[model samples]
Target: MTRASYVRRTSEIEHYFDRTALAAWKRLTGDQPVSGIRATVRQGREAMRQTLAGWLPRDLTGWRILDAGCGSGVLSLELMARGADVVGIDLSAQMVSFARQRAAELQTQRSVPTAGRVDFRSGDMLDPRLGRFDAVVAMDVLIHYAPEDARSVLEQFAERTRRGLLFTLAPSSHLLRAMLMIGKVFPRSDRAPAIYPTDPEQLAGQLVAQQHMSGWRVGRSQRISVGFYTSQAVEVVRS
Candidate 1:
């Protein structure tokens, strides 16, 4: 796709999420009753969170985290709870609004320190001017990208992160890829610009070739379904 079409696709996805933020929130991580796919997704999200917790610095008292495609700031809230400051960005204004509101509510209820609070903005991650952070996170955000674009994104992420990056992608396994394609038939999944399965090993190669980083430690995050995997990359020499 041309740059113009790629941008248009992202804009269209933003509009879709803006319209469905509330319902999507309920399905993804909201407190409402859930079953089937919603429950399955939640379980997967929790597992990813656990993986991230282990990947990040154990003591984040003064650390800064960048949450790209933050959605509803769910992970941002978790980071704040651990005393890490967060700057979150989402393409949809509606999603940003909800994220900011929820961040405020969580801060008030949890009585977390101000230094470790989170703030959100509406912006595209592909915007080149976004600054760096101690660690960068883009969870389920790359799901919309085609393969080449995803690789480009990884290189960009390498520059934007100081210590590490955390993300999830649908793997390139044929069975998993087919399941994802079938899932797209449902409107809930179809709203995304596209569902492109990725190979962690190949992506790691891209990172190594393009970003000159070969320290990624990848793992399977979507066990219930053969659909997704997560990757965590940090300097092997970090103290």
Candidate 2:
């Protein structure tokens, strides 16, 4: 994607999550009651999270992971439980703050010892200053970006990633395309950012063709669908 387009889209996402839908997102990620559609989304997201986590080593002691675009820090807490020192970064400062608060509450309520630590930050997930990691889990983060931009984002992560990378995308399909078109007809105030669907095969081919990603190859993949939520997980690992 062009630099200008990326910047504009990023700003839109920040605004949506930080101001437009903050309360709704909190309820969706929390145990609070939500509408039937959102409930299905919540279930789908949990399943996707588990799918991504299952790709990593069971015992993550001494492993450093990045929860890129970690909304509400659920995945970060899960990684910490597995003994991975995690850094959860999100574009929305409000989301990051909520994540911090949620993490603390869970820690207090559970009274469990976590072998790893989590540092939640509000910033761009592609920021290099966050440092390298053994694995990077970017659940549902790339689904909004155009395919090319999504691939470019992954290339940046590959530069800093040591062993593996896990992320999700909205797979291309006629039904999903129709859904996107239908969503656009909704009132502006009632809409979320537009989701861009991608073909997994094409994306994998692009990754393999990139010279910078020569050492990395696409690995396992899975798709999860529940009500209004559908996402595909793809893994890239060192050769």
Candidate 3:
């Protein structure tokens, strides 16, 4: 697809989630498991969470976090529980609404000592109006964008972060690329955004190893598997 069309389609993905927020929540938190595709998506969600959380700070007391693609507040909840003030952003109004609801539920259902000032906003991360934070987290979001767009997001997050930036991607590989191409045959009724695996090295170069960002270092997280896709994340730390 052309770059502009890809971006438009990527942004338009929120429409799919507006209709499938429940299913998206399943893929975000894996709180409930149904058979077939739902089960598989839940499994993937759990795996990704486990892998991503393993690399995060165990105690985020008083830290301010920006959850760039906070789908349904999955990671935002975790960060809040770890004692971080979190700002979660997503493109889908439904997803952001669900995330807000989940954040509220988290407060009432338990003593939310660490659930500090959690806020959910419906906006694209590429918006120039966004502000900086102690750390930024964008998990499994870049899979919907082309390489250029993915790189731009990385740079933008890096520029805004004060301490670190953590993110995951569906990494491109020879076999995986071919697999994605083949999967296009089975049409999906959900009309989800096309998943485009990105290159880890490209992300690292822009966010970590670039001369312009000379103070940053790279920390790779464990790979996460979701059957239809694979994820690899990195924590870009300011050295």
Candidate 4:
């Protein structure tokens, strides 16, 4: 897509969520943080759960968790439900507002601590002031950055996470590229996602040597469908 088209697409997405954020919380589940009302909520929730399973420890009772690019606070809300202390950040102000409202609503109705455990903030993915956490998560977020910037973002992720890190990205492969090109040409869907694609081999090389997080692994999560593959990766800090 052309630069102007990309900008327009991003703006359109932001505005869409800005209008629809609160409408999402009327139906709340433990999975609703990542499971906002889209044309496809079920698929989104499953994809988020699969991606988050990597950095989520079975016993994260008091562990501080960070949800980067926390859209509508779906995954952050889910983490709270599961007993982790969560801090979720998203680029969209409307999303942050919706997430906070959802938490309040859930807390009021459920009378549960799950709602109290989460904190949501508004910030850019590229901001430097974001703090550290025991585990950091960025589902379907990093792939938005250019491939050359992906390594830096990974390094920042490692730096911000004290124990572990998790994220998802679109695969850079000939087949996927061809598909993206064809999709853009025909306009099969207006909800075309911007992907910063990177080859798995290149990611492995960057993770192993450049960032020095050598034990990372990348694997596909439960596929919501054919086009949107949720992939998970984890890198344990050596310290």
Q: Which candidate is the best by lDDT?
A: 2
User: What lDDT score belongs to each candidate, Candidate 1 first?
Assistant: 0.67, 0.90, 0.74, 0.62
Q: Which stretches of candidate 2 lie over 4 Å from their true place?
A: 184-190
Point out the worst 10-residue segment of candidate 1 by lDDT.
Answer: 230-239
**What digit string (tens of lDDT, one per residue) describes model 3 on residues 87-168?**
8888878788878887777688885655466888998776657677888888878777767777667777778788887877
Q: For this target, which candidate reaches the highest TM-score against the unseen true structure?
A: 2
Model 4 lDDT tens row, 21-116: 435533432353443244254555555565566446666787788888787676777778778888888767867887798778878898455633
Q: TM-scores for all candidates?
A: 0.79, 0.95, 0.84, 0.70
Model 1, residue 151: C-alpha shift (Å): 0.9
Ranking by TM-score: 2, 3, 1, 4
Native-to-model Cα distance after best TM-score fit, residue 178 in candidate 1, in Å: 3.0
Candidate 4 residue 206 C-alpha distance from true site, Å: 1.4
Residue-level lDDT of model 1, residues 90-154, one tens digit each, is: 88887788777776776678655554778788987766666767777777777667767766676
Better of 1 and 2 by TM-score: 2
Clash pairs, model 2 backbone: none
Q: What tens digits encode model 2's per-residue C-alpha lDDT throughout 20-139?
A: 999999999999988889999999999999999999998999999999999899999989988999999999999999999999988899854578899999998888899999999999
